[model samples]
Target chain A: MSSWQIIQQSLPLFEKGFVLTLWLSFIGIIGSIIVGLICSLLKYFRVPILSKIAVIYVEVSRNTPLLVQLFFLYYAFPVLGFKLNAELCGIVGLIFLGGSYMAEGFSGGFDGVSKTQVETGKAIGLSQLQLARYVVFPQGLILSVPALAANMIFLIKETSIFTVIAIPEMTNTALDLIGMYYRSNEYLLMLVIGYALILIPLSLILTILEKRVRYGSFGN
Target chain B: MAHSGINVLFEGRNLIRLFGGLWTTVEIAGVALILGLLLGIVLGVLRTFPNRLLRLVLRLYLEFFRITPTVVLLFLFYYILPRQLGVNLPANQMAMLAFALWTSAEMSDIVRGALISVPKHQRESGMAIGLNRWQLYRYVLIPQAVSLELPATVNLVTRVIKTTSVLMLISVMDVINVGQQVVEANNQKFPTGVFWVYGMIFVMYFAIDYPLSWWAKRLDKKRLERANG
Candidate 1:
């Protein structure tokens, strides 16, 4: 089929798939950031046992394949009695996976906060909580924005794995459409374009954001 | 419920079959890493060029590969490429191609970062010694770059090994696929057999990835110590 013909046929389906893709990634990114921040804060505060467990969780999740993690969450959880639908499994698995990486990002950011800054905060009679909330947290967020943005982009791409468990995301939708039309060429090409559409703009925005943050007061 | 089927996964012959699958996984990752390093070096060098056009092209290539999910890329290559090109290749070859492409993008970034991290004065010193650009890079620049690049490169190798799991999607019969096959053969066991099978796969991945991670850490520490000294 001609490229235009393929575009005409696949555009509507691609739009729907794109929306689902956005939803999965958006939820995954927000969930991961919250989980990651909590874990990072726990580690930063030296929360003894919890910190140790958080370290293990971050290391294992970051090192392993996302596909394995997804499979473990999707297939093994039910065997262990926690039954989740494919969409829920995808989102939860992605959060767990993305959270680990984001934890590292936040930890790196936290580390970049100079020791003297925290010491100065303490000297000024600020409580530990006040120091973290006002001083360390703001600087850490700015310092870690680039890495966090990169990890979020990775999470967006990773939503494609939902197709394995049939979550009707972009790849799953594309597969079904291709199966119905028998036009693998058309749908797959459109799929690539669709992915680029999501990825390129996000990446460019991240780059610009990183540049701004770098040049902003964070550098000083 | 009582079990009726033979436990093939536990049998010696079936164990060998699974081992063969494990070997294939290693082979795919091993070859892809080597090819990826070569491509990564080339692209990395191109990325550092003074020419604007070369920089632009490399940037686009890097962004496309970086953002496009590996699963989507694998699907494109395995399913769509054959249809578009009207040619067929084995699943293993297709997996290698997709991985090599993906790994190259990642490795190039590592290479670029390492190269850029070298002090500019070192380049000036080489020029002051009357060395040409090629000679400067060959002797002074690349040696330091390689040292800095080693840890990141090792980390990339571990990534390739982990990423090979995606081959299960293409039906390459790797370790994960073997686990899936075992799960299918023993559905009556509910979750016990499947749990152990996946648990073993996780252990296998850890067994491979953890050591490389340690080695990368060791390299970083050594480099830091040498610099401090």
Candidate 2:
């Protein structure tokens, strides 16, 4: 079959998979941001036992591949009675993996706020929470934008692994088409374009945001 | 679920099988890293040239790999090579090819960064001493660049090792695949065997990779300290 013909036939299937990929990447990145912020704050504040757990969790997630973690969550968690569907497992796994990397980014940013800045905030009659909110967070966030951008891209790319656990994301859809098409390579091209479509624009936006963050446009 | 699948791990030669899988993972990643470093040196050096066209082309190559997921590349080569060129290679070779392609792009960027980071005066000094272009790179620029890029390269190696785990999808029989195999063989007797098998796989990866990451951080710190002084 001609490549264009195959694409025409495959577009519907690809669209279905693309929506799933978008959903997974969306939820995963948002959850990672929330989880990462909480963990980094805990570790930054030296939150006793919770800080230590956060540290270990970061180490474990950073070192292990997400594919294996997904396997653990999907195949094994049923035994523990926390059985999750494939899409849920994909979100949980991405957050589990992306959150630590994001935490590291956030922690780096927090540290980049400089000790002097923290002291200056303290000197202004600001409590720790107020200081964190008023002084440290903005500058730290500027420093972290690049790291957070990388983490976002990394997490998005990782959704490709969802196919392995049978979540039917973009890559999964392509793989299914390839299996049926008998050595045809057309769907593979679509899959790559599908990813570039998302990642390139996202990266461009993040670069703009990184620059905007420098000017204190936190709303972006 | 206390001690859920611990016994499933020690059952017979399962540990040995897991070890064998680890060996395969290491072997492929080792080969890819070495080949990637070599290829990257060539491309990276090319990227540093003053030619606009050359730099543009290299940038496109780098971004192509960067933007596309490596898992996609893995499947691309695995499928295309045999289908298009009739070059019929095995799964392991395809994994290595895909990984080497991806990491070489990463390494080349590191190389370009390291090369440019060498101060302009060093090049002038080499030129004043009547050193040719090749000799300047060989004698002065390379030595400094090597030390400058080492920490980043180590981190890249760590990334390659971790990312290579995706090979299980291509049926490369790496450690994770072996873990699944072990889990399958014993799943009936131990319903939670998948848990322990995969948990152990995670630990095995952490055990090897954490040290490398730590070493990279130390190297990075030392490099920063040297730069500060």
Candidate 3:
């Protein structure tokens, strides 16, 4: 069969997979950022016991792959009475991996704010809220923009690993097609196109965002 | 729903199988890293070619790699590319090729950055000493670039290691592949076998990752000290 013919035959299944990939990546990125924010804040504030827990969490998550974490959650947890759906497992796994990554970035951003600057704000009698509002937040956000962009792209690409657990995302869709119809080349081409459709725009938008954040900044 | 003991991880020949699988993962990543870095250095130097067409082709190669997920690349190489050419390679070799290609793209970019960062004056100095093009790169440019790029390169090593997990998706019998088989064999006896087995592999990955990351940090620290102190 012609490659075009194979792609044409696979369109409907591929569409379902493509949409799921987008949706999963979107939720995973957002959820990871939120989780990262909370965890980094805990460490930034030096919250008593939770900060220690946060450190361990970050280290563990940082050291492991998202694929294994998904396996642990989806396959292992069922034995322990937590039989969550595959999509749920994927999201949690993404957040687990991406959050620690972002926490590290966020904390690094938080740290990138100089200490003497904070002291200078204090000496000037800047209110606590005002100090954080005017000083820490903006700088942290600026410092964080590049890392956040990288993390977002990394998380999005990682959604492809969902094929193992049969999440029916783009990668899984291609795998299924190959299994059923043996059209490896055509369906694989479609899969790559499917991802390029998402990632190219994301990368461009991120570059623009980074430029905006970095523009007019005197010192990096 | 009972949580199985760690003994679930120790049952049968699971540990040996896992260790063997871990060895395969490292071998694949190691082959990719070594070959990729070697070729990447050549490509990096070539990346500065005066030819606009060559530069454009290189740029497209990088952009393609950057956007396409590695899994798709794996699929393309393993299931499609060689088949199209009517050549056959073992599954692991195909995995290695996919990873090496990805690593080369990344390392070439790094090498290009490092090479460019060596500054125009240094190249001028090399020419002032009557060094040929090959001699200049061989003695001065590459050595400096290697040192400058070491830490980032080491971090990339860790990435290559972690990414080998996807070898399982291709059914390459890597660490995760063994872990799955072990888990399946124990599914009847160890209800929580998934947790037990994967948790063990998690540690194994960390065991490999932790030291490399530490080494990278140390290199960064030494580089900083040499610059400042």
Chain A (alone) TM-scores for all candidate structures: 0.90, 0.93, 0.94
lDDT of 2: 0.89
For DockQ, the strongest prediction is: 3
After TM-score superposition, the amount by which residue A44's alpha carbon in candidate 2 deviates from its true location, in angstroms, is 1.7
lDDT of 2 by residue, A1-220 (tens): 7778889988999999999999999999999999999999999789999999999998899889999899999998898889899889999999999999899889878766766677777988999889989888877878888899989998999899888899999999999889988634788889989999998898899989888778862322
iRMSD in angstroms, per model = 1.5, 1.1, 1.1
Flag the better candidate by DockQ, 1 or 3: 3
Q: Report how closely model 1 matches the true complex, as a DockQ value.
A: 0.61
Per-residue CA lDDT of model 3 for A168-210, tens digit only, reads: 9999988988988887878888998999999999999999999
- lDDT tens per residue, model 1, A109-202: 8777766787888999999889989989888888899879988988998888788888988888888887787877778778888888888888
Superposed model 1: Cα runs more than 4 Å off: A114-135, A216-220, B1-14, B189-191, B217-229
Q: In CAPRI terms, where does candidate 1 land?
A: medium
Query: What order do you get sorting by lDDT, best first?
Result: 2, 3, 1
Q: Which residue pairs in candidate 1 collide?
A: none
Specify the poorest-scoring 10-residue window by lDDT in model 3 chain B.
Answer: B220-229
lDDT of 2 at B163: 91
Tell me which of candidates 1 and 2 scores higher on DockQ. Answer: 2
Per-candidate DockQ versus the true complex?
Answer: 0.61, 0.71, 0.73
